[model samples]
Target: MAPASPAGSAPASPRLPAPSRGRRPGMARLEVDRAFPRSPRGVLKIARTLVALAALICFLASDAHEAYTALAGMETVITGLFLLLYLLRLDARMRCLFWPLADIFNSVVAALFLLVVGLFAIIIKTNKGTLAGGVLGLILLVLCLVDVVLLCKKISLDKARGRSAPAK
Candidate 1:
């Protein structure tokens, strides 16, 4: 007669295969986590972004004659802030995309603003006109608006999906 195996010790019935690694076992892979402004830093970023947007709107809504004179000296400051935020945001987003064309566009815009600011400062010192600076400021303002719109869309999508964004 064959020998009887001990209870609970029959070699575990030829153990089942281990589950595959590196993939979610049974659940859908969660994409974005929390929406924008979810953290303190993100809140601050959103506030600054809104402020920049408001400034742009104010610059555009007022009568050109009145706003132009009032906003002339602020061109450099606003553009600089916008460029800084744009670069920070682009850096944060770079890892999300394989190609990251947004990063490239942001870098190009920031470089252009830097050049404008530098040239504007030099020209002001030499009593030259401020037309070029004004134009650059307008361009940067438009770019900031575009960024804001894109961010809003992303945040809305993340919210709809009910996932927290992965921290950068």
Candidate 2:
């Protein structure tokens, strides 16, 4: 049996602790698109990252010129960023940025830089690492070009499909 409050007074309610904004250990769930890494585009991005890292390592190990080292390092970081964006499905979440066009621009610019720096590295090679890094850079250049081509083709197809649909 419970006692009622006197004089028509309301009962007091218990208060709850406010939730913490930060993620807790073992409690935070990262919604990664697991299927992404297995897709062709994801595979290509992964290959680009791996090659960029290899080139960076070669440059660092051989004490190649600063320009070669910088280019390799920058490319590795940028490619990894793109990979993370896709893996985490950020492209879908963040609607402001047009990811496909950005990706194409990145690919084209990277290809140009790699071509120039890679030739220089090869021509002025003072050690084996420089030569290897240059070759890898050339490989990276090809990969970037491939990425650009794929992205362009995909974009064109998407636009074509969109145009074929009846307007609302």
Candidate 3:
């Protein structure tokens, strides 16, 4: 017979409870939604993205070549930022990606860029194509303005709460 084991000893071949469903034993898993449907800023960011995308689509379908050219760069920047934020949101879990100051800065820049592009495109020309692009561009600019306002409010609230700004 084997020597008596110490009191309260576990089995010689210790076994872990069967891993849940598909995960391997000892793997750490963090639960996160496929998309950030719960975050307000995430929704707002997505709305801004849709507005920018609409402007781009209008430019493509419109006859206004000049307006499209002028607005292209600004739209690209907004779209890129949107994609980055959205991709990061997939893994955000419960962690706050809070960067009120940075968001404010981005919102301001996007608003200014959209405003300038919209005005420049309108002053330069107007056709059926330009009309479509211009109208969409205006909408995009409004969304940017909303983003700026929301971000500014968040920044002020954060400051009042004594939270330092995010690192550059």
Candidate 4:
């Protein structure tokens, strides 16, 4: 038997029990249900990544010009709606990964795009009166749709995961 610790001194170290099967000894057991990137920062990072991808597609695609015009026209309306939804989401305390300020800025950018689209459409209509801008607009609209769908899917998955996790 080990000698007892002296009075007023640190207690003797107790022998730790063996870890259960498949676990290593001395390793901590983490709560497996914990969510990944479990903070607003993580969410924001994900949102930024998605936004970057969209931007890249818009900038690099050779055939995007035709679609871009129509998309510009719709940008303001869609962005306003997005901003409103985001505000509501924040009010509800939803776990958004990105920074609120950044999100707001992004929404503003979307609105600006819409404004630009409108201007371009008007100029083209008045000067050329042709469907020259249709292609870019369509492409942009499609990209927006894809973005929305992906975002919804991600949110759904996150919510489902959150629900399935055991309470801390």
Ranking by lDDT: 2, 3, 1, 4
lDDT of candidates 1 onward, in order = 0.46, 0.91, 0.64, 0.46
**Residue 77: error of model 3 in Å?**
5.6
Instruction: Give the per-residue lDDT of model 1 (tens digit) for 1-168.
Output: 667788866643677879876776775443443543475435544543454344344334442333333343344354445445444454344455522245345435544553555345335533222343344445545554455555556656766897446555
lDDT of 4 by residue, 1-168 (tens): 778878898876788977698877776544331332353433443343344345334433424455453453345344444444453344234444443334445545554564466345545553332223433443444444444454555557767889435368
| Model 4: ten consecutive residues of lowest lDDT | 126-135
- Highest-scoring model, TM-score: 2
Clashing pairs in 3: 63-129
Residue pairs that clash (backbone atoms under 3 angstroms), model 1: 32-164, 33-163, 33-164, 33-165, 34-164, 34-165
Q: For residues 1-168, what per-residue lDDT tens digits would candidate 3 score against the true structure? A: 877778998647767787489887776665444565456666777776676766676677665565465465456565566546555543234236554555667777767766776776677655665556666677777876777786687667878987655455
Q: For model 4, state the Cα shift of residue 76 in Å.
A: 1.8
Residue 134 lDDT in candidate 4:
32
Indicate the residue-level lDDT of 34 in model 2: 98
Tell me the deviation in Å of residue 5 in model 4: 59
lDDT of 2 by residue, 69-92 (tens): 999999999999999998988877
Query: Per-residue error at 86 for model 4, in Å?
Result: 3.0
lDDT for predicted candidate 3 compared with the true structure = 0.64
Which of 1 and 4 is the better model by TM-score? 4
Deviation in Å, model 2, residue 17 alpha carbon: 11
- What ordering of candidates by TM-score runs from best to worst? 2, 3, 4, 1
Candidate number that wins on lDDT, 1 or 3: 3
Q: Which stretches of candidate 3 lie over 4 Å from their true place?
A: 1-40, 66-98, 165-168
